[model samples]
Target: MRHVLAAATLAVSATACVSTATPDTEPKGVVVDPISWGPCTDIVRPDGEPPARQEPGVRCGKLTVPLDYDNPDLGTIDLALIKIAATDQSRRLGSLVFNFGGPGGSGVDTLAQAAKMFDTLRTRYDLVSFDPRGVDRSSGVRCGSNADMDAYVELNTLPPTQKTREAGRAANQRFAELCKRDASRLLPYIGTGNTARDMDRLRAALGDAKLNYLGMSYGTQLGAVYATKYPNKVGRVVLDAPLDPSVTFRQRTLAQTRGFQQAYESFLKDCVKEGCELGDTVKAADANVMRLMYKLVDKPLRVGNRRLTQGLASTGLAAALYSEGAWPFLETALAQADKGRGDALIYLADSYTGRSKDGTYTTQMSSFPAITCVDSAERPDEGELTRTWKEAIKISPLFGSEGAGGICTSWPVAGNNEARKVNAKGSAPILVVGGKGDPATPYQWAPSLTRQLGNATLLTYEGQGHGSYSSGNKCIQSMVNSFLLKGKVPNQDVACAAA
Candidate 1:
């Protein structure tokens, strides 16, 4: 899940120095004081359940970490944490830390809402989540006001023409300028490598012997980097709907385009079965959808006070592709769009971009591109992306280019995490789960991640949507539960039916 080509998204760690590590790889001088935990304050979930922060016994604290790991004495920034303490303390298995996907998403809310799902584990393990640096509650990246983001996201991203791409780049550059004005200090240090270092500090602060981790989507990439960096400190690991650590930014975009195409097929099948007004065949419906997008590109549709542009329409479609349950919403949006109404899709797009009904926003929009641009180094320029425009359309005329026309390459800072494989050698087995029809991280990425990791097991769910675990796939949920609970990995890859 990306939105308006800006969602190429955005943490941390275990460990001692590996013999092969360079000077930069070893976090020798870095020191963090132990966190003093206290009663948790209520934190509104940026993109999840908002009420969990008020739950009893929930604890919140701030861990001070080096602003730049390479320069530990420079200064420190606080990484926020939320904890649900273990109930069966006598039989506890230490803490299970989490990194929810958004590179920009807050982990505090993710773990808080998920406390009930692991009822048994909750008694045996302390559930913990942290807002990685540059995310919510942490050193968040603040660009311009919500009005600025509203304007930026509305910039057209379709057709990939030189003129339109430049316009998009110019608009993105303006947003980047706003970020540099407000958040330039955190920009350079917001890479995933730095985030991994922060995680190690968190692990040490918690007084845990080893890290028990559960990461999803972009979080999986963070977990892999952490495992590789701190091989000896790893415990059981679960990477669900993972990103291929070695793929370049362009490769990731094309893959996701195809992924969304596949997911759209699923949505189309379900919609046609349910007798929607879209069409009778995939070709007819898809063409109509493409025509709608092109129409929006030529002229945005005004629905109430907001104008629904191609980017918003595409983002709305991409957002619903994230979960099968949201597919019906897409159908309704499409049918309404057919009747010259864009309210449903506008609402959906607003949801994806973290916009409120009152037109405000969380930090997800700015931080998404900021953290993403810093993590990977291969964001293409206008020329490179334009060259691939035809092939991108061939892969997905609707979303093939969502990964293209991005303004990351035009940012103020450079990326730190280079394109490479993450081999967490000399570590415990890492479980990699893939949703067969996951549009965001894609299904094929799991196999790539599974192979890249030194010790990894691939768990496949033959299903539609972005993630599998705890999304109603009992086999996946059970398999992951067993792995996290008993340190077990499947003898071979386990495949499950759609949930």
Candidate 2:
């Protein structure tokens, strides 16, 4: 059921502590405060675990934004924010905002965890990020209780039988109903369009004439939409591991399936060469993984008081595939699972889903369906869903259930989904980075997004994983640094060999 909606894309880190309150009257401008910053305390894991580490000089605060931009009288919600100032103030550039993939990912939390990656860029630009509306600590959406969510997330969306299919449909309906009950007020205004508007407001507040941004995965979608709406306001933008918004829902799903299939096969090939315990041949490795997936469907593997179901297992595998660095952990998890120990795979699954040790879930999963369902208007008929599911399995039997009927089909509100033909005609040159082996946001999307932008340069990472710039590739890093730091757009598309 985790993949029943669009692919969750990137794995985010950390959380923020913020609160919201409304004013007696509408403000003259965008609903906002002066953003009084302080030391970090509540940066959290998805499961409510306390943050492991908090970087010094990294300040946390809240930005109050309109609950409804068009109808400003509706009051306001607080967006969680984090900022690390530039090191070289004498030559400091403007703030560089970032959105790291999940439409539901916490920018504040992610910025906190990933700030070290941008130390060189931080020498000039103030690294900033926030939780968009309807994300964790930003009036985040809530569907049901912890127990209810557990049952919902574990539902067999890839039902092999009619009964399981019916059960899954029932769960989807219930989940949607719960969302409507819990977060109806915030649902309509949380789409990417409003977020783009919010970003502009953020820029104005930061005293910047234009926005400099680095967006990855789903964040690229947010960045592209922003450029289309505020082309004149775009400064230096980097869209890494970009998503091709022009693709139809089915096309995206299938393409993602193929991308992951390729990555998974690549992993298997490596496992064989490394003489991993999984197998000695690619076919055998594939069979071993598939065997584990199929076996867990009915015979759940015990992990203490919990069990590793097929849904969670699939999610864990997909999560590991997001980054090549996690391949070793994935291999270990797979080997452990083969011996009837599900702890390792379960740990990976919990990390992906943001499940805490306390059995509470993070707002990421709840907000994921809420935002994606509202953003996507596609409600394929049962026939179409069945066809998509069949086709997706063919693309990758391991992850094919993702192509089945998604939560959006049963959502209470109809999405105002557009064709997403973004052409930021007057925007500054955008640097689009694509990973050749990106599984979530396929490498092809990099070039596709490049074409979609009115002005852009494509940087292809001839490598593996979900994102390029964060892969620690000096070539990718150098090119992206030049683009953002110096505003130099390459005359032609560039490709960097995987490190």
**Candidate whose lDDT is highest:** 2
- Residue-wise C-alpha lDDT for candidate 1, range 1-499, written one tens digit per residue: 2121111121110112122453124355645588878876656542322454377768999999889866867798999999888898899899999887776877875666556666766778888999889986898888998778888888777775667667876887788899989998889988888888888888888888688998888889889888888888889889988888776666767887788788888888888788867888877887788888889988888887889999889888887777776777688898898789998888778766867667777677877888788876766865677766656778876776566656677789887553244778788889999888888887778887877785799999998777777466688888888899898788687799985
**Whole-structure CA lDDT of model 2:** 0.78
Candidate RMSDs in Å, in order, are 4.4, 6.1
* Model 1 spans > 4 angstroms off: 1-31, 39-42, 45-53, 298-304, 379-382, 418-421
> Candidate 2: where are CA atoms >4 Å away?
1-32, 45-48, 157-164
TM-scores of all predicted structures:
0.89, 0.92
Candidate 2 lDDT by residue in tens digits, 1-499: 2221112234341011111111112236434457778887777643345667776668988877788877879998888888899989898989999998776888876777667789989999999999888888888888889988887766554544546566766788898999999988888888887787778778877778889999988889889888877777889999988888766667878888888889899888877888888887898888888888888888989888888988888778888788777787789999999889998888778877767778887688878877777776777777776777778877776676655546688888888654154677667889999999988888777777888786888988998888888777899999999988988886676789987
Minimum summed lDDT over a 10-residue window in model 1 is located at: 6-15
